[model samples]
Target: MNTVSQTLGQAPSAHVYKNDVRRKLLLIVVFFILTVLAVITDLLCGSGTLPWHVALNGVFHPDQASPMVHVVMWDLRMPVTITAVLSGIGLAIAGSLMQTVLDNPLAEPFTLGISSAAGFGAALVIVFQTSLVSFLPVDYLLTANAFIFSLVTVLFIGIFAARKGLSVEMIVMLGIAVHFIFSALLGLAQYVANVDQLQSLVFWMMGSLQKSTWTQVGINAVIIVLVVPILLLLSWQISALRGFGEQAQVLGISVARLRMLLLTFSALLASAITATIGVVGFIGLVAPHVARMLVGEDQRFAQLMTMIVGALIMTLSSIVSKMLIPGVILPIGMVTSLLGVPFFVWLVFGRSMGRR
Candidate 1:
């Protein structure tokens, strides 16, 4: 009788589990469809608004399309649209990994000073006309500098965290300190810059998709493709760490090593994107939470959803940037900041109230 009772009790739970999985899967598909629509909307809504048929023809049959349509679609809009998507994916994934590894809801590349560091690095090149790598072309000097500085900042933070056995809170505080330090340095760089240098530095810091190219798109794609599989392979361990560091360590997960690895990869993703397109904020912080809300905290599903949500948000932001000024495209970073600031406020207060 007891055995029968146990079996009957377990049956409902198994069925419920299957149902939950199905629901999550369905949500993923739904979000994916939404992302596709958002991408199409982005491709359609640029300055010289092409009709769907024209846009489709330009994309699919460039040879047959008018020269103007082909140039507008291929030479201009396509790279920007693709870059936004790739940047969103990269930032969101980096944010998700940082949050999970650090066990802090607010931890992300921007908040952790990685983006600021990259900006400062880029500013160095802009102000001094200096190349960190002698072999890099003049065009790539700023990018290389940004990437290297961002990497160095994260490595410093990771090493400090590992050596000091800092708590999550301490790690966040350290990041904040790093952020302030870099901001001050960036300000100093700007203060001494000439009119042209200042204008260029300010614009880059504001983030724009205007400078994106096929080469940048390819580089961003390769980074995302490489980093994602490594994270996926360690998803189970990451999910476990999200629960409790002590527990994860007990399970032989090497929490310290895992955290260091995540930090490095997150920095890599954030740095590469920031170097390529300047500092677009909040996607990292916002997308992971949205993904978690939709799919709970299973890293596998949450990470994938985070990428989709990030891409959707970014693509939508790109559309808004174009539409807001009619003829003038507002900086993409400004749009994201406007959207993100309110959400960030709510996130902070809501968490505080929940704690109380």
Candidate 2:
């Protein structure tokens, strides 16, 4: 077995690794191009149908465009586009971190029950608007409840799991438990609601970018901008967990502590986005898996690509939401599910078939 030993022991040459990285970077560039195209299309193809040049002019030289064009491009389309990008980046990176920290390909805020908790919170406000939180304006009520409940769920899991020192398995179990409890509460809220209230709750839960505003976009952008770079700095240690696992523990990584910190960050990012945009599902999940396919499991590249893919998917979904109906905008969550579910299926069975 000397020949086999020699083959296994020889590491990949630096040149080889550099070439691989170049190829992946090229793929990332292509995806970014696609995302830019999607954003431009979104800006140009709304209900008003501003011409590409006119829309560009509206954005770049708003004073030249008519007030109507200026309003549509600057106030409406710009915020939505920015929000979609921010939400996509946040959910995608959050999903990547959750999947890595939990060691579960399927782990995301939705799967772990965090989104459900947020949804339940929003649903509660919809069903009982003014009854539970009378002081807050109706506009802020749902968002406040959703954000609070989502954080409560995370705090519950983190606090309880941290008591035992934040094992991966324990944290995951706690999240699953959080998911079920919140899901039941959501169901109960649905049952007690009147028809109009039920419709409102359902619509919100389905997700919509119709509510996007510059303020929401700015807040989300700040959070994601801060969190993503920090996660990237820890990329090598995070990547190590995939292969080295407990060996990372031996190497003084404090794998449990790292997982806890990452998990908390991921949860916070996902919750904040969900609170603003409603529950846009699966972009978090499918984006990272798609990124992993394009680039390997290297978290640095994978996470960045995940953000791009997520932004692409969400932006496309936003386009579909607008285009599917003439004047009535469809919910973005429905479009994402339609696109993401098929990709998710491909990710699962595609790998199994390839292994064969």
Candidate 3:
């Protein structure tokens, strides 16, 4: 009789839990739809307008369309939209990994000085292209320098964190210090640069998809495709790491090794995107929190939702960047910042008020 009664009592809770799961799954579907819509919007609403059907046709059957429309759609619009999606997904994953591993709400590539380091490297290329070994073309030089410097910054942080015993406070503090150092270096570059070089450096730092090309987009897509499955496979471990913390070690999770592995993975993702596209801010910091809200603490769901949310945010930002001025495209970084700050402020204040 007691067992029967307990079973009956538990059934209601289990039913409620199932309902909650269904609701979150429904929400994920909704986000997926929104992301698709955002991508369509990006394809349709660029500098020159195209009919929806025409854009769709041009995308899939470009040979059937006018050469001008085909080139615009395939060569220009396609690459940027794809780049935005890939960058968004990569950065969101990186940000979530950093937040979980570092146990800091504000943990992100930007906060950890990774993007700043990349900017400094790009600035060097922009300001002194002739002086800094001009064997490679400008585009490759910029990417090479950004990638190298960003990795160097990560190495620096890793060494310091290892020395300091990998405490959260030490990592965050060192990240902040590194960010400031890179910022100062970037400032110096700007000061010494000629007017054209200064303009290029400043614009690159602001970020844009205007420079997106098929090759760059394809490279980012391939890297993201390769990495995401591994991340998803380890999602449960990541979730446990976030929830269990010190207890994770007792549970045989190899907390230190896991942290280092995820940190390197996340940094690599962030550095690749940052190196290629300059700096697209706030999506990394904001997307993961939004995903957490929708998906709770399960890293699998959060990871998927974070990618969708990141893609949606970037696509929307791309659309807004062009539409804000009819003929003038604002930097995507500027648009993201303008949209992201208000959302970020609300999130911080809401969390503080215990309104999660």
Name the candidate that leads on TM-score: 1
Of 1 and 3, the candidate ranking higher by TM-score: 1
Better of 2 and 3 by TM-score: 3
Q: List the residue pairs that clash in candidate 1.
A: none
Distance from true position, residue 258, model 2, in Å?
A: 0.7
For model 3, residues 1-356, the per-residue Cα lDDT tens digits are 57876777465777888898888889999999999989988998788867788988998888899998899898899998999899999889889888987888877766678988998889878886632435777668887788778877986787668766968888888888999999999899899999999988888888888898887887788879888999899888898899999688877788887888788878888888988888988999999999998888888789999999999999999999999999889999999999999988998899899987
Error of 3 at 48 (Å): 1.8
Q: Highest lDDT: which candidate?
A: 1
Model 2, runs deviating above 4 Å: 1-12, 130-138, 165-167, 354-356
Cα-based TM-score, every candidate: 0.95, 0.91, 0.94
Model 1 Cα lDDT, one tens digit per residue, 136-249:
888888888998888889889889888999987888889899999999999999999999999999999999988998989998999999999998898888888887775788
Off by over 4 Å in 1: 1-11
Task: For model 3, state the Cα shift of residue 188 in Å.
Answer: 1.0
Instruction: Please give the lDDT score at residue 130 for candidate 3.
Output: 35
Question: What value does the lDDT take at residue 230 in candidate 1?
Answer: 91
**Predicted candidate 2 versus true structure: per-residue lDDT over 16-51, tens digit per residue:** 899999999999999999999999888887877578
lDDT of each: 0.88, 0.84, 0.86
